[model samples]
Target: MSPTLEFSFRIAITVDAPTIVSSDPARGKRQLIPILGGEVSGALEGHVLPGGVDSQFIQPDGLCRLSARYALATKDGTVYIENNGIRRLPSAFTANLFGDDMGFFKHVPVEDIYFKATPTFEVDDPRLHWLTESVFICDAKRTPDTVNLDMYRVL
Candidate 1:
């Protein structure tokens, strides 16, 4: 029997409060937290779009989706939040690693926040490979809890 290979990574996040020009209460709350011991989904060549862009597609693949639920707290204990979510990235950024938009963030923000995740395998498929080691900044307008952002791996 082949021994299972588990891929792991360490994630570091920095959250800052919104700038003076922008009026968001969550701005300037710079924080960095590290999440150790995470798992990944099967990796593939991703998918191509109408505009001729390739992405690590996870829509149809059952093995490439990750749902993480974890907790975070400030050293002072003044703030605490539950960090959890499922996310992925386009293959272009991971493939090239350089461009105007790396597809890492769906949106930018300013907020009082700390980010981390506890990764687990939701599906079982040997052919699938997971790749989620970057931090994302999704837009507050599109999601709930504008001040709190959820982070995840590429899977």
Candidate 2:
């Protein structure tokens, strides 16, 4: 049987500038984008805590592998999340196209890119324990200064 997806929640994450670590021809470019703060809504409602970061490895071909860690504060308790995903640039845009200008990605058409992630949740509150057992998938869109995600639970 085919699995179905149910809408879980949405997170609108504000971010600061990305710090480019290094550009290696063999390994790719590494960057860290800081998470400032944001809001969550839908099935889960909360505020995203500050100080989290999204670490990225951009390959020569413009494929980005990203891992983001952050926390959410709800009325009940806090939920820790680790989301990992891949983003593929449009065929017309290559890694060399942006070069050292990582900010150029902010202008890319979000609809044209393949950006998706699987998020794992950890929570201490028994009331929110359902989040720990379910599998989640998220679709992400990136703006100039924010990253928005719509999360869905797999069933």
Candidate 3:
């Protein structure tokens, strides 16, 4: 008899700010935009891409939504599979991508940050496996500030 397959993986992403050049707000608060030219280290199981690079995402309205060109994995970090197609964030989400208090670019020193990720299929490549959507939040320039990993998974 054939055995069922289990897949999974874990990601450790280090996020930093100051990708784009911007001046402080004239009178209101300001938040730092994230730079995506960092390192992505992790292991994949079911369907995933071993090593891939992410691009800078800047929404037309000025909200940045970066896309990671990678795949999903199974539970055990053994089986890697490909996704059917791409995915995208709903218009509602993109409308206020950075405005969301739970998302990035919050000027407040939040004790907790939130993240959300979806999938897009516009860049379909057989070489890679599944595409994913992810989100995260971090404290704004606080001593105890940290980049939080809100979510990461195949969509």
Candidate 4:
């Protein structure tokens, strides 16, 4: 039988401007989006501090990939979460891509794109350390200024 996953909660993260680092024709487009600041609610509560970043890649095939590293500080202590994910855009959305106009990514219909990720937590506080021992998944969403993730733990 398949494993059952428990629903945790949603974490809405706000991001700052993305600094495009590379745009090589052979390699995928790379950009580093800064973590401006945000909050965590639902099962776990805390604030997402500044200084973390999401290093993203957009492949030539139009696939969107994400590599994000950030920290969360709860009332008790802190933990670091590393998230990796992939996004698939609807065919209609992909057909409209052009040069220098990636802005559409921020406004795509929520139902038109699919995003998913696996996240690992590095925890030091014993109370919250159980996070490091579980398997987690996130349904990630992106807006012009934020990233919304609904996380779940696999049991």
Predicted structure with the largest TM-score when compared to the true one:
2
83-111 per-residue lDDT for model 1 (tens digits):
33323334332322122222334432223
Best by lDDT: 2
Instruction: Write model 3 residue lDDT over 1-155, tens digit each, in one string.
Output: 65432222333333343333332323222233332322223433233334533343444443344444543333433322121211133444444334324333343333332233443332233333343222222112211223322223422
RMSD of 4: 2.1
lDDT of 4 by residue, 1-155 (tens): 79887888677898876788777545667788889779888778988988999888878666878899999888768878899998888766654332444567766887678899999998878888778888999988877667898899998
**Model 4 local distance difference test score:** 0.81
Root-mean-square deviation of candidate 1: 18.1
Q: In the order shown, what is each candidate's alpha-carbon RMSD?
A: 18.1, 1.7, 11.0, 2.1
lDDT of each: 0.25, 0.88, 0.32, 0.81
Query: TM-score order of candidates, best first?
Result: 2, 4, 3, 1
Better of 3 and 4 by lDDT: 4
Whole-model lDDT for model 3 versus the true structure?
0.32
- Model 2 poorest 10 in a row by lDDT: 93-102
Name the TM-score of candidate 3: 0.29
Worst 10 residues of 4 by lDDT: 94-103
Better of 1 and 2 by lDDT: 2
